[model samples]
Target: MQLLSPTATTYSELQNAYEHFNKVLFDNALPACLITLQREKRTCGYFSAQRWANVEGQFTDEIALNPAYFAVTPIVETMQTLVHEMVHLWQHHFGKPGRGRYHNDEWANKMESIGLMPSSTGQPGGKRTGDHMGDYAVEGGRFLMACQALLTAQFKLSWYDRFPAEEHVAHGQASYASQLSDPAAAISPAQANQALANVVKPTVKAARQSEDGTSLQAPNRSNRIKYTCPSCAQQVWGKPGLRLLCGGENCDSIPFV
Candidate 1:
């Protein structure tokens, strides 16, 4: 047997997660960025704008996840930190970013649109935007659907840092956080919505099965869900595991991909 390739197993998993989340949550609109493991004390993770460039002069933003807290926090919770930074990246490229490290209203709204609620304390009713902030996963939200899809596909980070950080936060609703992070509907539209809301039915997809050999149950939502308002062409993306329609004013068209 060949020895395992550590970097391939580790970093590549994060890269895959970034791409997967980009498609599922952001309508594949967010630009590609760097995913790095960092050891910053008391920091779960961070997003630095235009932090790196290749010899060819391509610049990409950087998202550094503190590996120290990986083992202390649930894996899904840790992934939540990754996504929190991703929201910063989203604002940096597509929306108005707050000055310095402050999280602005646009970023906060975007986070809510994606089913991640901003909070200063990482829980409900916490401040929505600030220099220091965290988020909790929303019930029956897009982020949960995305996470379920990833899990159904058997994607995971193969390696984790041995040392943990001092500051640890359980950033999502873990079952809520899971779809958004490691915890589970476990990530598709149906079961993810069902798991989060207990409404939609779950489906079975390609994957490793249970001990009895039955296929595992997953969410109903698939990847790359998009909707466009017919009258205004106002597009929106999400995977709520519910029937989607163009919700523009006077444009309630019930069509989608």
Candidate 2:
């Protein structure tokens, strides 16, 4: 894997990571709904964090892990976090609303599909991108603590509600606290618009190097992932067995890959 200099992770660089990882996860058969990774605050784990956007039916960015918590986060923990968040995204898009996103048989089945288990928190269970899910069980504590201060008093409620419609909207804004933390909301609607244009679609291209040093370009096929904008209901394509786009040029809704 290639190390991205702190200086190199500009918005464009972030977009590249978004494209690359979406393709990677999808190609691996665990396609996510949406993904973004940026240097944002109040998120835990790695240099980034991820969550499901219920209202938008996609996954949020991998918010960078605060430097203070990096030591304990193992590779498996990070992969679990990614898979966990992606499963939530899948539920939001493909599964019915009002369904529990975690701690249920569906979650277990999804985790199993990805070689993970909800009960495997910090315990030996399955394979991930690497072997290290225990890191979150350790490192995630501080982030949860910090998030308590940065997040709303009812952060749990901020995620979902029993009402299917409300649950959808609530999950869409997991980053609301982080967005508020921003001295400036540097991620503009225009920039988000640009990103929506570049999400993966079925096409053949030469294998190209990602910041992570892996090549993500893949062969085109009919079974590619498809998405319908939760906001607009416009159908679009993604990495395979996943959706990638919304209708409007400036889509604030979540996306998958």
TM-score of each: 0.64, 0.31
lDDT accuracy of residue 72 in candidate 1: 33
lDDT of 2: 0.31
Residue-level error in angstroms, candidate 1, position 214:
39
Q: Give the TM-score of candidate 1.
A: 0.64
Each model's lDDT comes to: 0.58, 0.31
Off by over 4 Å in 2: 1-21, 24-68, 97-102, 124-257
Cα lDDT tens digits, model 2, 120-179, are: 223334323332222122222333333333223221100101111211111112112212
- Per-residue accuracy of model 1 over 168-235 as CA lDDT, tens digit each: 21111122343333424323221122122222112222122211100011223343333333345455
Prediction-by-prediction clash tally: 16, 22
- lDDT of residue 26 for candidate 1: 78
